[model samples]
Target: MRRVIVIPARLSSTRLKEKPLTIIVDKPLIRWVVEGCLKTGEEVILATDSERIADTVKDLNVKVVYTPSELPSGSDRVAYALRDERVDHVINYQGDEPFVYTEDIKRLFKALEDFPVATLACRDTEFYKDPASVKVVIAEDGTALYFSRSSIPFMKLHSDLYPLKHVGIYAFRKEVLLEFTSWGQGHLERLESLEQLRLLEKGLKIKVLLTDNYYHGVDTEDDVKVVSERLLKKLSNPTTNW
Candidate 1:
């Protein structure tokens, strides 16, 4: 089946305005994300609400769509962009995640063969447990039971066993993508301020792929500095682990 990746980018970020244009390692963050998405070898489209971001990526010879800014979340933006498209699957790539690994992306794509929706989760930290950092709980079969801003899988002793961090990447069947867009956000979605919960609330099955490696994203100016330093160091040491 044909698979396409759609990146949801907007000019209005609450913590860092015009975050898509922010540079990490002298390249626009969105460019890095699009580069990673392209590594999956799938057709990629950058869905954004601003002409600046569109033009910025256009210089990189990347495809982009002008989506409205009012969409509730990244999934909504991707759903809108893929409407009437011929692709069999769609993967929602966040613009801010410049450090996302291409191998991890391919793993999630491979996972979609057995699940309705596919995403990645990694070991959690204090940063991962923050309300701003959305969390997910997965059943033994590797299917996500829920996603929330609050910490999940309250364990008495084996809490370390379930310390999973939710990544923003998601692979969706074309129909499921459209269906998610059609449904209104649910109560759990509102309480946690996470859209993925709406899918769980609707009984949709989401596959959770675990990975040992993950990357931090640029959310604020401080985040930009940190990611920039990391990317620079990564570039400096080509043999270093990602």
Candidate 2:
């Protein structure tokens, strides 16, 4: 299937302003995300509403699609950007995930052959209590049952349960993406403030793939420092498996 990666970047951020242009280890945060996607050698496009963000990546050898500023979410911006494209699949690689692994991206692509939508998740227990860390519960067949900002499957009595941290990376069939954008906000989605729930509410299946690779997404100033240090280490050790 023909596939392409689309990154949604916006200048306005509630926690960190001008997030895409924020400097992380001498390079813009968006630049690092774009570069990581580039390692896959797939066509990459940046979807944004700001001309300033467009100019920042002008020399990156990637296409920049200008979207409207009123788009509600990054997923909406991505759908608008690929409206006229002929791609069969679109990977919504969030601009904030600078530490996204190319291998995990490829795995997500492969997963789309069997499922219409797929995402990456890694095992983690430390961040389960943190609402910012989304959690996913999967069925026996590897299909996601639910995605929540709150800690799921309350370990009220069990100590062996560990939560899966949902990675922001997603691969969507072109038609599915369009259909998702057309549907109104779901009750669960609106309440949880998690967009993926809208799909589940619509009876669409989302496959979850467990990955060993760890991804760091920058949402606050403290995240910036953490990502910067990890980025420096990755650059220094090119052979390091993520």
Clashing pairs in 1: none
RMSD of each: 1.6, 1.5
Q: Write the per-residue lDDT of candidate 2 for residues 63-167, one digit (tens) a residue.
A: 999998889999999999999999999899999998766677888888889999999888889898999999988898888999988898687775443588999
Runs off by more than 4 Å, candidate 2: 156-161
TM agreement with the true structure for every prediction: 0.93, 0.95
Please, what are the lDDT tens digits per residue for candidate 1 over residues 1-242? 78888899988988887789887778788888888777766788999999988877675546788888898788889988888678787888888888666677788788877888998888776654577777788788989888877767665566665767888788998898899889988998888777888889999899988888757777988888888887888899978876
The reply for model 1, stretches above 4 Å from the true place, is none
lDDT of 2: 0.89
Going through the candidates in the order shown, the clash numbers are: 0, 0
